[model samples]
Target: MLIRFKSPVAADVLMLGDNAQQLLRLVGREGQLKGIFEVDDQPHIIELLDAAVAAEAQAAEAAADAGGKAPARPLVSLRQRVWPLREMLHQAHRERVAVVWGV
Candidate 1:
């Protein structure tokens, strides 16, 4: 299933089910078929996601620094995958709009 996130202030953002669920998990909204990110909550959600991405990057770097077999790189990094949704959240926050998914 693909999740389509829509907001009045930005273009719709789309993600695969598992990927979308993982992103939602960062903000404590996982396992729902449908949900909303209210304007009031967007900033916190963004911060959580940014921190999670940064942590993932740091962990990957640490693994590489350990000098075993270099960790296999993901075709798409978490940061790249989350960019669109992050932009949507930022736009919604700035414009005081809510983002809704699975609508």
Candidate 2:
């Protein structure tokens, strides 16, 4: 179950179901198979996503620094996972395009 986000402003962004749900919740959206994001919501969502990515990176770094085997090697760094969404959101905000998941 992959979530594919589509918009006129950019190419589709795909995520695994779990990753997609996590992102949806992270962005304060309904974590459902299908949902819509209004153009006006993109900026705030992007902001939150940015914060989440930073937080995750910091956590991973801390764990590594503690000799906890984190190694700064996240199997799925939120930054990498969330980047396409950010790109899509930025494009949507600039173009007034709506983004949809599971379309």
Candidate lDDT values, in order = 0.91, 0.87
lDDT of 1 at 4: 97
Query: How far in Å is the alpha carbon of 7 misplaced in model 1?
Result: 0.2
- How badly does each model clash, as a count of residue pairs? 0, 0
Model 2, range 1-103, lDDT digits (tens) per residue? 8889999889999888989998998987755788888998888899999999888878877897998777556577788889898999999889998999887
Residue range 4-95, candidate 1, lDDT tens digits: 99998898998999999999888899899899998888999999999999999988888889986767888988999889999999988988
Worst 10 residues of 2 by lDDT: 68-77
lDDT of 2: 0.87
Tell me each candidate's TM-score: 0.95, 0.86
Pairing residues by index, what is the TM-score of model 1?
0.95
